[model samples]
Target: MNLTWRSSSILPRTSRFYQKSFRVVSTESRKESAQQEQEVTHDQQRDPVLSEEKKARAPFLKNLFLGRFDKDVLGFPELNKARQKNFNAAIAPALKSLMDAVDPRRTDAEGTVPDSVLKELKNQRILGGTVSEDYGGLGLNAMEQCLVAEFTGSDASVAGIVNASNNMVIQVLFPNSISAVNKYGSAEIKQKYLPRLASGQLTAAWCLTEETGGSDTTMLNARAAKTLDGKFFDVTGKKIWVINAEKADLFLVFVRIQDKDELHNPCDITSAILVEKSEAVALSPCPSAGLRGAGIQNITFNKAHVPVEHLLGDTLDGNEIAFETLANFRCASAAQVAATMRGLLTKTIRHCIDRMAFGQTVADFDMVREHLGKLAVWTYAVESMAYLTAGMTDSGEYPDTQMECAATKVFSSEKMWSCLSECLVLLGSKSCSPKEGYEQYLRDSYCHHHHGGANDILRLYIGLKGLEYAGKEMQALVKVMRHPYDNPSIYMKKNFRGLWESIRFNKDNIKLKMHLYGHIHPTLKHISLQPEAEILERLVLRFPVVIEHVLIEHGAYIPQRQMLLRRMADCIIYLHALTAVLARASRSYCIGLRHANVE
Candidate 1:
């Protein structure tokens, strides 16, 4: 009998007698083939010409990487007045009641959020803030969702529950699936699911993470085999650390299609299926150090039958849906982190003011003040970026914000962990005690660093993705350089443009044209003249040049240099934060918000 590698039928087969001897060879060959196939698929996905033509608007940070500052992004975003009023009048009271009912210490000790609190959450429509009003939801926009997330995020467990439903499930379901009728869920599926989800009559879990495929969604081991009738799929696999698993009435599952033709490219083999809770679905609680009340569990699908219409998108569209969903989710998580940091800062400040130190309250000490100052600054920066990104999402101008969202998540999560650690130190032994709840906050913050995507991995993604775009832009320049004689006039034109830019810089013309000084409020004019602002301007001007040089130097092998990529990511993140801070401060000053000058 002929034995073949299951992943690809094109591979050469071997007799049963030689299977053991050729096992290593077959495995290695399969991996190499898979890698080659994946690269080609990714290259197609990253086609610059295609992307540029399809793009309706360029994202702020990505444009910065290309050395063009989008002046429009300089305007700070504000919540819609009508939405703000609605939130205050309706959602605020409900949120307050939910908060009042929740006891973090009790929730942690019992390893479960009380059912009463969950009911309160549903009654408040907190679980369905982002769902459409037509579907029995609040129909909050991106900025509004962020505001609500901030309130829930003060308790990490609650944030996890709400986000899992709103960000992952609702986001993926309606936007990607229903909105694109030709591509994803049928009308019947939408009618069946949306209203129930919005009413909180059903809860959903996003089940993309497998034990083997933690951060790498493409490596998912789950398989969905179409039954002979072709009307249903038998999904079989186990997903670990699935949030809302214990309570989810519906699950959005990602699995590889067990079809011979689709198996050739692993990247394109994944599909998403909606599986309603059934006897075929088994759940086992997976306890964690934090987010104990989040109802995280290991879920096994033992031949769970899902109707063909329940498929979220077209076959092999799982990766796209998953990524788009995650990008939005990560952007929103920054808001959660900002809220968590703000809460920690508030608690720390109150404690320092009341607790005595050497001669007076701890707040009187220079060291304590320094820590507080750092925490406050970071909190401000994170909050600024969070809302700015939310505004970008809400405007619907930029079709892609994957890189920007990743950068925000990385920055916010890290800063949250750092800020909480500082708070812990400020509170000393008291922080370690469960009574203070600082330790709980610290544990929850630590989890954010790895929640959506690990910080280190995301850093590489941010750097490499930027580099990919820069590299594409540099291709023409490289061709000119490689054979200057072949394209003398084109080369000379390029040279002259470079020379003109340099000359313009020396004459301060570039600075005059590119400066954001004109955009800020008159009262904040001095801020534009500050050294930090000057440094930011210099970095913005210098970054693209540095990026070009790095690409020229490293070429295709740059992804392997993790340290360099990390540094690149750090620089981009800092620039983004500085830009956000300036925009926010300028808006505050212009609006004459109280104490705006202090910002």
Candidate 2:
């Protein structure tokens, strides 16, 4: 290698002549070289301290990495921090006031939380976070939405007032479907709908479910056909459980486009646009055990004329749109439910401290303390996992998201319900009665199981996905163990520290797998299936391929020092589960500590 050194004085001459020479040469080549240097400098500026801090935080990061799917793929800290600051300053207070209004605390009467509550959220632009700023929406990131959802769990009904409207619209705005909105929906749709939908001027819903088929998009029975001028469809169908439908200004209805005279074609389901309530034949409210304030209704579209532009995406791609939207919805649902548990824990701790038994506070009892501890631990673990997943999404890591979303929703919902029950028991009779507010929390929290997806279905998904990852890691391990020469002990020792420093890296990946599966299996059944099994097999097969490439790329430079791979791997795996539990457990502790120390 040749090296040249120049002092600041010589640098001036070097720069002066270099600039003249560069001007004489091709400008494009110089621009390309400068751009490459700029990119390197930009990345360095983005995290000058990150490399150092990451080294110190290796053990913690490693803990997060073990035993879960790839979530770091979507982690976006810059966006997350920006949104958090905005919510704390702008949206949080507005939401707090809305919660107070519909709380039943002021009135001591029972009726639906009014549309005005949602209007207040709109007025504050809480419902527009996902919309572009140009459209009068907040345009917040995924983690920001997660934070907003957490704060709302302080009062879910009010959160529903805000989120239900936003979710209905934003759910349709990902990369794939935005084109449909732009092409088919009128310019008027963006002008009229974007601003209000962004500003909460009008709430919305997509009516797709039926009594016979909910998630099974192929089983859709609703039909739409072209009528007069190639721009309209006279549609008729019954849509069950349409959220925010009764009062929403718009409805995106999925109607099956007929294949000749067939009742249904798996690929023929198409969506129609319905903007007029009058055209909507009838909207009847559905009675519900929970989410009472949500305007969930059954809507009948009888000879409803829908505009051609109202058809979203391609006619046949309706099912694809629905599945993708549902996946995102389920992931967000996990974040929302985790917040509910945090809020419930706060309320329960206060009850335990204030409510006495045997001349001591209920929280003072051993069993009560143990229950609270467990709940706090579980809640923390859920939040950590949920936040990690949300961060990944905001960062645009989409591939590994499917499994993480399923796991987060399942773990959070099940843990929250259990936490809610413990708090109910601690509160005694008042928790069960509507007068005390605990019953309502219980009602709303339990309802989450049915909202995005049934708990059983989510469990099946988690079981299969977990097995798939475990299988991949195991196969990778076996390959490395067999080809010991490929990763010589000396090479392993050299890069050992750096590898351990990375939160995702783990050793004794086998022991970590056993520990993870041991806990996961009790919670889920039917883990062995061909789809997941094949995925695992493929992952295992790729282990040597990936290792070979890495070694060839870094050869002598690769680090291989090892200190506590087994311990680090174990910690990494357990910590992911631990953080979720701790969030649940700590909320109660915070509440109890505050109550006992204060009046």
Candidate 2, 118-169: lDDT as tens digits: 6677777776666656577765555556666766666555555445555445
| Stretch of 10 with least lDDT, candidate 2 | 1-10
Provide TM-scores for the models.
0.85, 0.65
Candidate achieving the largest lDDT = 1
Model 1, 244-328: lDDT tens digits are 8988999999998854354464333788899999999999979798888889899999999998888887776787888777777
Q: Give the TM-score of candidate 2.
A: 0.65
Question: Model 1 clash pairs?
Answer: none
> Candidate 2: lDDT over CA atoms?
0.53
